[model samples]
Target chain A: MFKGKKIIVFGDRDGVPGPAIAACMKAAGAEVVLTVTECFV
Target chain B: MYDPVIKACSHVLIHTPSFVRYGSKPSREIDDSTTPVLPAIETHLRSFEEAVEYPPNQVFIGNLHPDRLNGIEQPWYRHPVEDASRYGAYGEIMPEEEFLGLMKLADDFDLMWIEKESAPMIKKSLQAHPFWNNSDLGKIDAAVEMARIHDKIENQGSLPLYCHGRIVGCMHRHHEKDDALKAQVLMENLMAKASGALALTHLLKKSDIRADEIDLLLNCSEEAVGDRYNRGGGGLAKAIGEMCGCVSATGCDIKAFCVGPIYALVHAAGLVKSGLFNKVVVVGGGSMAKLGMKFKGHLAKGMPILEDVLGGLAFLVTGDDGESPSIRMDSIGKHDIGSGSSQQNIMESLVLKPLDRMGKKITDVDRYAVELQNPEVTVPAGSGNVPLTNYRMIGALAVLRREMNREGIDRFVLEHGMPGFSPTQGHIPAAVPFLGHAIDAIKRGEMNNAMFVARGSLFLGRMTQLSDGLSFLIEKNPGRKAPN
Candidate 1:
């Protein structure tokens, strides 16, 4: 139900559904942005 | 009148506690995809409902009866692991479905999915709660087709989320490598963060202090928030801070086995005194790894796994308002490398020396907060009442020092000691647990001074044979009598 909601995640890579969850949320219209993990911070 | 002291104390819960829950340790039946839901396990879990609602919880945060925990019979050997509310209080137990919804809200992506069957249940749960009134779930298209969910489970959704033996949801892996963010690790980390964040927000509300007022945040939970290169490095502080709406705040993680919160308190107090920050919060989340940490002993006695709840604490130490309790900065205790590891030596170094330097006696402090783990949770598992043991030790010390005769030890304990009420979440149950109650006592002038003492095993990391501890005193504000 996150339509139009802006969201940010800390760790979002393989093994963690963070990216997938973010991608799904984005597909559902939430504005997904930012990752604070090692490579992406 | 504003001394560097605690202004308020608050505690919150996630409620969806389980003794044998978590993704990392899956059973043979749940080890991989393609398995049907494990009905037996869920049934076993649900049977525990009765244990969680016991007299302790409601009065616990002191909602209804304040003396329930004090009145309950000791050595509740009737059961193992489960607290009295074996089934977790309805007020606290946020049913599995509801918890998934929370996990979703905290999720920035559509990576979380509940079966079409479970989605409605989650929705109903979310709609019923005040905490979810402003949620965006209704705005999102949440129900996932089983076929689609199955595909995700088979291909990318390797990390599964189970509720009541059903494939309710799955956490996916975004990488092809083995060392990447594993679904197992993700689930564990997310569970801790979500729970901790919820507790933190609840504390902010309980204290009626705006989150933005917090200048710093610290996550003393056992979870690590990092990536491959720095797998063990952490930043849960910043993540939880942002979630708590500490907009201008920046935070870092602190770890020292179980003594973290005490160390964090000393550091925060120093920060407030140093003029680097005005208001600081030291918060910790419960851990999944610690869930059912004592399952074997509990099960040996046919009791449900009791390590159900993930307990957490949040307290604010700001410029003392002269009326609130001030932290005694004059003689805080710290265990040095030379501090011997024996019980007597440790106690002397940790409890006595510091107080002596401050010209205080063992009996001077009105109350002492140490390992207050609930006896009910520990006794059934063969571990005796921890807090009482600590108090008895102190009483013994008092006797040796000629402060009290052996006969007076019991009286001293009865007057100064308290039953353990905290969950056995190691660090979570340490001295920090009594903070809320201590704040209440000081405000009512029932206690003039309370010393919080905590010890941690350095042997866990295999780096040192030494034990570590720190002690700090909080006392009734002397009004204009002192500047802390």
Candidate 2:
């Protein structure tokens, strides 16, 4: 739905849904840049 | 004005039996009500699933489950997923068979069923998906059996799990059923995870967005996730992201009881507006604790069990485009720690103060979406109508503010408030559901501004007596492009 929209995403490694937010942004075709403070995995 | 606009929102529902017995409140509600209806209405979820609307914007999931009233399908009946009019912006009500497949995908989250038993069952049970490879599952079965067999025998309690009328596997209680870290809790948590993943998947699918494009994810549900040492809520966002192909995503969990979604929305909006992030998504998985929550009430009412659904929502807030409704940052409402707990106090802070700050009246908002639990589901349970109660409070606030006369309160409510259409899934009925409708209405010139109000009971956690609330306005696009 967000076609051609310039969407920059930010996520936290600490939160449960942060990576979901980041990955969804990318999947939505947003130009994403993920910043992981710490990797939980 | 705010930089972040609601790019899209998708709602998804799934019917699973996990909530029927394991959900504490629902199980208790069933036991407490004299006329408990067990197994009689298990098929009702499938029937009701046919009626709920998909995306353009829909409100009520409607409590009329035909199968409960007449044990078979009527010639006129059509499932929501099949019908074009019934489905909402988010997605259609996924059938039970598909949802069972998802539970398998989410199994690694401390959930395990007997492989020799469930494996063959799942082969026939699970719907087709990329993750449903029997070969891949064989590896998990081999590894899990060696470890799980040690816990399956004498001391552990094994509860056989069922799905779509077939035995899936025995859910061995590694500890007591009440043990928060073991069987029951683990099942509930994993169901929520799978449900959330399904929603996120649909949201991405409906929005035509790519999973890898997601930058930030926030899980607003209050699910606890951890090992034996530290049982807590964490990393669900990333796990869901990974499940949906969001390889580059990072995430966090936001906990505020029912108000968590609103908090996540505000935080996401701020990040987008502040140029810290552009595409921000907020998602809340369905609550296992809430499923079958009012089954007994529905049974007494001779209606279908309406609480069998798992509610999941995913929405993207991004820098504004000329077409989408944008979030108004300046008028955001918050109930501070010192804010006294009272109906008037909450209404004042959430409704009037924000409007006052925005230099608008109570009547300025075209509609208010708050705690919109369907009366059909709640009234039978003696919970009364939650959305109606909320509307009355707002109408009473309007009367107090002299926005309208007390005598016209009903009329005001009729005009400004909507009938409760959401399932009683706590946070699912909160403000977020309205975003889909408000966006549609605004685009159609039906309304210039709409407010999304959410309130959470902090007292539920026993940590505080204060009630939490969050409110924000979504206005017409203003027909302007965002500046670089």
Candidate 3:
């Protein structure tokens, strides 16, 4: 469903991290330009 | 800058055939008049050799990896590991006598009393064990006379302790009339603590972390340790920590039936990430009440009882080392109160929802660790292959999500699923059993990521009709911080 999409992700250490979202998006044919996983707390 | 990684895990087992009669179902049947006594139980009890040689038990103690079970012949009990040792890479398989001595060592108020004749055997065994010394064995009191022990059992309500079908010791009642403080319950609680302490001690050794450095301890065993004033109001964590010399650690019990360990793991991770503790340890002891839970079925099938051992496990969670696999805190999935209780609904909530949030599909996870109850123990009881059932369900979900067609489900499962290898200790089998292997495999670069999923039946407590579940992912550490 994410085919041909350009995505940027901000992930949380306590929730979902950015690399995981990037992996998912990439699996769905998206181009992930940036990914960051932060501790929001 | 705080990230928690699983540093090490240790799995230990105690072969306690004598305790099988004390398990919930067996005791209930014993007390009831309608059902006949299980005639085949005593004859069917596996010996120490069989217990150590059993494939699943070997897997539980880390003598053999779970993947090795695939190549071994089915009806795994028939094909024993050649020259299996009492100790494994992760932990040891302790015999009943040493565990009895351990029960005495774990006892503070002199509740457990070993017969005078058997004292030397226990003392020598404990003395030779890798983890203990003479000073620790000093906690074992001089043996009680057979007359006094018989008195305690005959009229004082003490539970008899056995080894090799002999009366080796007895546990005295804590209170005269309180059922919660009775000898039987106390025995169960002590077994949990003693076995749990062994696992914790091993975890300290495996992780190269000192006992006092364990700043927090979590007791996730299913045993309830409390007095009559508050049955199940317990302090297993501190009890276990005290036995293991985790002097700086004080903690409490967490209960969610089979899902207790996973809940404790998440809590431990949170504690470490929040800087509440530098190192947190989660330990679960084997349930004496779960022993021989499926003995009747095994007996009916003319097979030896497979549920003869008590399983214990411990995991160390510390600030990320930039080498060990890091728990994906962001990818945690929980079963909500509103989530439907159907198989598909539960899978979607626990398996797919977290993956969806992470922008991944079912195929992305290298492996999925779920209920790992040994199929040999469960199959005869009509419970089916639990872990495989979970894998197929996830595969089915992939089909539903259009990740693959229906025919590809088997291929998906084969690539991502592992055979069930955990002992049938209720909480012991629920996904967490794979932690030790997961850490090793990821570090060895054999796999990228694995998801641990735990499901509990809330109805077992009779509080509600709802089912419960939780999941989290563990992947190879990226070894870099995210940009602010």
Best by TM-score: 3
Give the C-alpha lDDT of model 1. Answer: 0.66
Candidate 2, residue A35: lDDT = 23
lDDT of 1 at B201: 65
**Docking outcome class, model 3:** incorrect
Q: Between prediction 1 and prediction 2, which has the larger TM-score? A: 1
TM-score against native, each model: 0.81, 0.78, 0.90
B453-474, model 3: which lDDT tens digit per residue? 9877665565665567889999
lDDT of 2 by residue, B365-419 (tens): 8888887676667777766766666788888888998888999888877788876
Give the i-RMS of model 1 in Å: 19.0
| Model 1: fnat (fraction of native contacts) | 0.00
Minimal lDDT window, size 10, model 1 chain B: B82-91
